[model samples]
Target: MADIDVLRDVAPGVMPAYRALVASGELYSDAAQGMAAEKLQSLWVKLRGYDPQPKAAGQNGWVGKLLRRKQVDEAGEHPNGLYLVGEVGRGKSMLMDLFFAAADVPRKRRIHFHEFMQETHKRFHKIKADPAVSDPIPPLADMIAAEAALLCFDEFQVHDIVDAMILGRLFEALFERAVVVVATSNTLPDDLFKGKPGRDAFLPFIALIKKHLDVLVLEAARDYRRERVQGLRAWYVPANRYADAALEEVFGELTAGVPAGPESLYVSGRKVVVPLAANGVAWFDFSALCGVALGPGDYLALATHFSALLIDGIPRLSPDNFDEARRFVTLVDALYEHRVKLYASAAALPDELYKSGEGAAIFERTASRLVEMQSEEYMRLPHLT
Candidate 1:
């Protein structure tokens, strides 16, 4: 297990790491974050080579020197970092971002945990193409350590057996190289991979987390995302100029007036163009979404990337565009399952969106889901990715 020593400064109120958190004004002031910032400040001091004491050997001489060398080696090889866990929108990720920006390490990287796992999967696949490579995890972990001495991850989660099985070995190697990690997650270490099929096989990974990292829970009671959009209009009707303007205004409120730009995303090797994306939300026209030849895979990928979607000009479905209506159904299912917030300007209500379409009977379920998704309950659901 990695060793930890409690550190206390002479002045109890000096908190260097809370600067960003206070400046952002994104959350209410809380003692939980202030304490976390102090811990992070201690880590930063160590990473900056701020140790003051030097060790001296006793009368045991060479024997004592050998024992001390072994201890030093072991301590040098193990990770010394922080693992932060909390519920959704408690500002765990936000705090990690502040700490990462303030850390003075020569090589550090902060990334979404899902994107890191995706890259890891890609690396393993590429290595496996060479039949001689039996186990690729060690080399991949080495590559990761070579790239970054400090790794900061956002929204870490484990749902699938593939990720669950490999994490133990991959992280063991990382810790052995003294690669520090700071991660934020919605779930605690013990609860990761809790209900999956090969859960027993995943236990060692949880153990590794406890051994190598200091786990802290953010105790903030509020969900900041919900607070931000609470009581705001979610659905617009009639597809008129006023509804269009309202949709745009809602987008601005959610995104804080950030400029939207196009992004190309890949799903099953298929390229999907998101025309307007900013601040974790994407905006799309009806034709760009339902009018194209797309499937559930593409829609699922969209849900994975964005927290919310603003779709404009959804027309009343008809028999002529039955295929588009089918795609729309698939899209709604993906978004609903992932709890991606939906903001739309449609020709009519959810029940009336496809009243007389070729697939009207099949779309009853879709309309029902659309109606449910606009509720306060659905908006409060946490995002899967």
Candidate 2:
């Protein structure tokens, strides 16, 4: 590990770098977002030379069980981390990204909270399956702490009871090993897992968070993400060159700075190849999706992975093509349920798209949702995975 002073000399402070970006017009300046950034800057400064390695205290003289025990005992050695709370579109994620990028610590990681929990459960199962290991939680915590001394989680949430039960012990042990956690959540720490079954058992985890992390509530009059979603020119009628050009622009805007590439996701042992993807935005053609025989599970998987979706084509529908129209309805339902942003160039407006289909009555709800999705209110709802 680098010495504390050495890291301090080399690491550019977060606030100045952020202001520089704003001055250069790379990021718009906002007080609420900047406040959270300042708090992150404080944590950034405090994390220097704080090592999460099991042998951080050295194994020179006492190189066995004593050394390992010493690592867990020194939980008070590092500065407290930060927990940022805010509304869905209030730039909580953006601030998390900024802090993580500017953090000059070794073995740091930034990941979506849902994805992390999924992997955590998987890791726990693997550890449990190993007959050699008696207790899995401590080892799992040690492994995670060793990998990411500084962990940043975006959209920290507790939707599943299984995850809720595991987090308390896992995070408690991780904290003891000098792992610094910075997380962004839409819910306040006290409010997490509230009203869920077994929530009383989850109380200690909330207390542990309050003890180890400085909680900051971020608020802004303008919802930046909602504005971005509202500005979108979505749901065009009678697909033409104009709609094509508009969708291309939307793709460019959403995927700016992120490289465009192909991605493949597996659902139920089946492969779904995304023609183009960058960041959490996916671009697909209507033929590639509804034209092919895909079920609700496939659509759900796509909706789960992508925060925003841009479909390029949709032919007008009737009883002649009820199958595709039904598929379209399923796709829209998945997208709506997940709060995914949608952009498409279709042959007709959503209302007129499938008016005469066998299931067009059901399609009406989809059309209504399609129109509702474009509204600012709908756009402000957070994307659910």
Candidate 3:
């Protein structure tokens, strides 16, 4: 048996919690095995030197020395912060899991970026309404601090105005209480708050991040997701006679044991109601289901909703069908965020979705996003020989 299997068999009870934590991605396996503290320190040093794979000879170099200092400080009273930036699937999340698992801290929580922002917004609104709240800011700050000494966030990207506005203050409060933050993102810190018309107002927050966290770039361009399934055939389910029944089965499995309300269901604060037309065909509104307006509490509520989706109305949308396209984008984002499996039916493949139009750019981006939603490998699939 493998070492992990052996470890599991030898200590089944203790291993169960560790396995559960790792499986839930709240803890990293390396950390559970007591290797992340050292590995993370080395990884941090290598990242600083622009080396994805550091050489044995350079293990004791200046970067290495700096890493040792950071590790020592992190292990001490002053919690250290780490920021990992890279393209999707370059092991950023995995590395974060390792670091989070390895940290000896008592209180820790790892949450997806979308879910975290949603939760923060939910809590903010709750505190706003309560008169007995008594100094909302400090109490709120203390609450997060008490709940988590270390906060590890995955898929950390800032594209919306609401998130941009409060992220600084939120981080500032957490940092003030010496909460260590480890985050992974596809974009660099400088590129994060960019392009917004009034982004200048967020400059102080940018400075605060630079001051509090040690930023590291994982520059390897190779897509780890691609590497994992280079030779695997794409999974495709064509719309057919049995498609609806199969889709319903998948949906039933996802929503099993949950109470039924409207044919449409609401997950998280976001609505997942299935709007039916006069013909009785089931459809859904993505924007209402998963948007930044909702919070983590909403997602927690949604977790029990549906694990898979089957939407049959997708086709080559036109300018007249902009609403449909927008809804599709929303569904794509929700599925990606929740890591839910999906089987969709479009009148044509993504490439053929936009045949010709002046609005081709919008269609192209949407189509690309849809393709990505289906399978990242589909983006690189070779045309039929």
Candidate 4:
């Protein structure tokens, strides 16, 4: 690793030098250097249960595809990059990291989706606000272009309308500037905005993605989280001096104290609040929640603020409840993707959440996802800790 860092700094700007170093195999390679690379490496290590081995030529698999793409790109045709999609715990991010580390791109930038969006949003707003700014988009686009010939994004899911609207323009700018994009996502490009109302508005963005990139699915059936969940019977709770302090800390972290007073908590511009009953139990009206309007951006905000979550009053959601069920599913999906620890006291386990009629199938699917969320392996340790 030390040798690779030195090599990265000292090597002349040529492909043969990198190829020679990689062939010599003296430096210990790692995917942790960049965000995308780290994500890919983590997934690779998890899936293989060990560090990756060198590949043989003509090997045709995920590794092969990536290597082949790297070779083609090295030869200087078009930007040969990959977009990896898969189920949770399938190691899409890990694979991406390996590719980034092994591939010899002159410049590269790997970013987490939320972090990248926040930065882009911040930059865009700053540029718009500056009176001296002229042609902000081109310079900003060129800046990103200059910094990275290859760009990798992790957890690339789209639920926010604003993000959806801008993605087209952003990608358009990126493509025009000839930046190669590689992303790891749980959803397909077409299905990205699934279930978002009026998502047809973003079809052009979807089209642009299809036009610019090749998409691959990693279909290996293993659910790594399932093993982790079964291994750890209970969620981790911090030791506290007092139970009340612990409770307050946990609840505060989860809710961000969105004024649990008389007014309802605003989600996506909707007025929905967590209510405390006579018994002092907290419950939220899932049906009235607006993740789309408030945007999935808040999910990152909430994640940044909280380390642990205890969702109570879920049992109150009736069997026939569709809207609440959908909301719960979305929440679970987002939380799971963020690797958040979840604890809930429900009237029934996920299996019993929907035992009744017509909505049973969808409820069952949601139930399966919920169970996956509880898997001990799936839970990620808090970043702060």
Candidate 5:
């Protein structure tokens, strides 16, 4: 793809670069995705150190209309930003990645939303530690705004109350500093943090998002992620090389040619590494997840980020390793709640996995979920981000 910095001053913009990919058969044209690209093209041109000025008196019609946002903004001014919303596999992240890389802005950052919030928390913690630091948010926001004038976020969703509360004030300050934001999410602006505990306290953040960012829904005619997951066996028993091969196929199909690599997920400022991850699918050994001392937060973060999980070698549960057994159950609960596609190679069938143990009863419920996940109904369900 031609750099948007060149596309910025030149005639050919982001849309033409997208078309070149289509012509080369690397991508297929979708009107919905095209519209999103156009919107991004508008941003790509204007964000290259372009200083927008306050409109003079009587500056009306198309240019004036473009200067001030309607519906999403009541403050009469909004920074350059967009919030892309759609179901999975609409190419939201792909387009955002292109724009982020190609945007001419020198000070820019692209990050997963959770990681951004985690980093923010870390910064806040350090600032709060200083006795003289009466308020941390203002200076913190200034530093962030200066560092990344343009911020691109992948998979923007809030699952924690701590993040929820901090976002309102933090973003308000970021917007005040003219830090542009572009984010992608599976949920709508209204539905973010919906029905979560302490959701009422998070409403202000929702309002601020709607106020500052234009929400664009990328509607695509082609979404094969459901079909892709359906083709794979959700649970494979008698862990063997054949089962491993099946999982390899599943990972390939899910990621759609994205290169696999080790992924470190941050939970409460700690890193939980996945052996291999690409797109929204993560691959891990059962021991890596269960044998390790990971809590509900780690499990929840894993469930939230990945749409599909491939776990290798889930051994039979016993009283000897009840802690791992319990963690396995917790992991299953988180995955089921988020409707993540679970593919695993196990030593035995769910019911037979735990023969006799104090944690056997708990395994039964997870077993039932494993069975249900393989059903046609479950295969059709959308992964909740």
Candidate 6:
């Protein structure tokens, strides 16, 4: 652990660096963001000499036990971390990324909130399989604490009751172990488990968050992402080489030239491969999403993992391919519910995508949603994933 002054000397502050970057026209400047970054920088300083290691094995003696108790008593006083809340594209995740990168903490991790919860669920299930392990939360928290003294979560959200039920216990253990957490979310702590069944049981977790973190609202008025897509076409008709080229260009621009590659997701123990993915955007052929056998669950899972989806070659549908058309409807419903931005090169306009089909009645609703999704209003809605 370096001395506080040494840490300060090594890292001047996040705001100064942030200002320089904004001045270089590399980042959008916001005063609210600067305040949050400054606070994160202060936290970085506080974390310099902070260590989360447990006492040595030989320190079980009475004097060592007394010293350990004192250490435990002082752990909570280490530092209060940050909880940043804002609308989508308000730069919450980007600023947190900058903070995580600039911080010199020895044990730190940055992960998407959904991915973190997915890993947590997997670990819990694995540990619970052993009947002898009565309590899994503490062990899980210990495992996380041993690896990351600082845990930064991006796009923080809670949708599953199982995750909600365990978070209080898991986080309590982590806080006791002096594991600091910084997270960015579109929702406030109080509204995290809103409208969910068994949400009453999740209130304690919300209270835990309020007690441990400094809640900051990043009220940046600009939606940077929507701005990037404002004038660009979101929907393309007559799926042709021109539309194909436009989709490719938009995908590349949104992902900042990151090469797209194959991505697979496990939904209910079945692997669903994405043909192309970069950053948090996924791309797929029409058959990959709708022409194949799939259900609402798979679409819901996809909605939870991606910010935007681009589908290519959506064909016109009739009774002969009603099943595929039905699946497409389900996929659109899921994406719309999660407020995921959509880009597609379809055989025709949304209203003309399905006609003279047994499923055409419901496809009308899907068509309506497709139109709404392309609107600036829908694009401005925060993505749940």
- Clash tally for model 5: 0
Candidate 4 per-residue lDDT, tens place, 1-385, comes to 2134434544332222233334555322322222333333333332222112222344433222332332234332344345777776554654564455554556777776765776776777778788887656755665677677678887787767877777778777766555667887778998988889769888898887877667777764454333323343322222223423444444443332223433333333445344431111233233333223333544444443233344544543445565566566666656666565665545567787677766677667767867776664455432221
Q: How far is candidate 4 from the true structure (C-alpha RMSD, Å)?
A: 15.0
Local accuracy of candidate 2 as per-residue lDDT tens digits, 1-385? 1112222333476676666656655556889878877888887777654554564443432123322322234333566888888877676766676577677776799877876886788889999999998989977986787788889987788878899889999998887667778888878999999899999999999999999899999986576655554566778766789888888888876654456889988666678899999757899989898989899999998887787899987888887888888898999999999999999999888888886737878988999999998887777788877
Task: Enumerate clash totals for all models, in the order shown.
Answer: 0, 0, 7, 12, 0, 0
lDDT of 6: 0.80
lDDT of 4: 0.53
Q: For residues 58-153, what per-residue lDDT tens digits would candidate 5 score against the true structure?
A: 554323343332312444344559999998778888788767766877778998787688789989999989998899997787678768768999
TM-score of 6: 0.84
TM-score of 4: 0.49
**Global local distance difference test of model 5:** 0.80
Q: Can you give the TM-score per candidate against the true fold?
A: 0.82, 0.84, 0.54, 0.49, 0.80, 0.84
TM-score, model 5 to reference: 0.80
**Regions more than 4 Å wrong, model 5:** 1-17, 24-26, 49-79, 159-161, 193-204, 376-385
Candidate order, TM-score descending: 2, 6, 1, 5, 3, 4
Q: Rank the candidates by lDDT, best first.
A: 6, 5, 2, 1, 3, 4
**Number of clashing pairs, model 2?**
0
Expressed as tens digits, the lDDT of each residue in 1-385 for candidate 6 is 1112223334355665566567656566777878888888888777764555753434432222322322234323546789999888887876786677677678899988888998899999898888988998866876888888789998888988888888999998787767789999999998998999999889999999998899999988688777766677988888999989989877875664345789988887889888889667899889888888888989998898888999989999888888888888889999999999999998899998887647889888999999999987888888877
Tell me the whole-model lDDT of each prediction, alpha carbons only. 0.75, 0.78, 0.53, 0.53, 0.80, 0.80
Question: Which residues of candidate 3, in runs, are more than 4 Å off?
Answer: 1-77, 132-135, 235-266, 269-385
Clashing pairs in model 3, backbone N/Cα/C closer than 3 A: 118-295, 118-296, 119-296, 264-273, 264-274, 268-298, 269-298
CA lDDT of 119 in candidate 4?
72
Error of 1 at 251 (Å): 3.1
lDDT of 3 at 235: 25
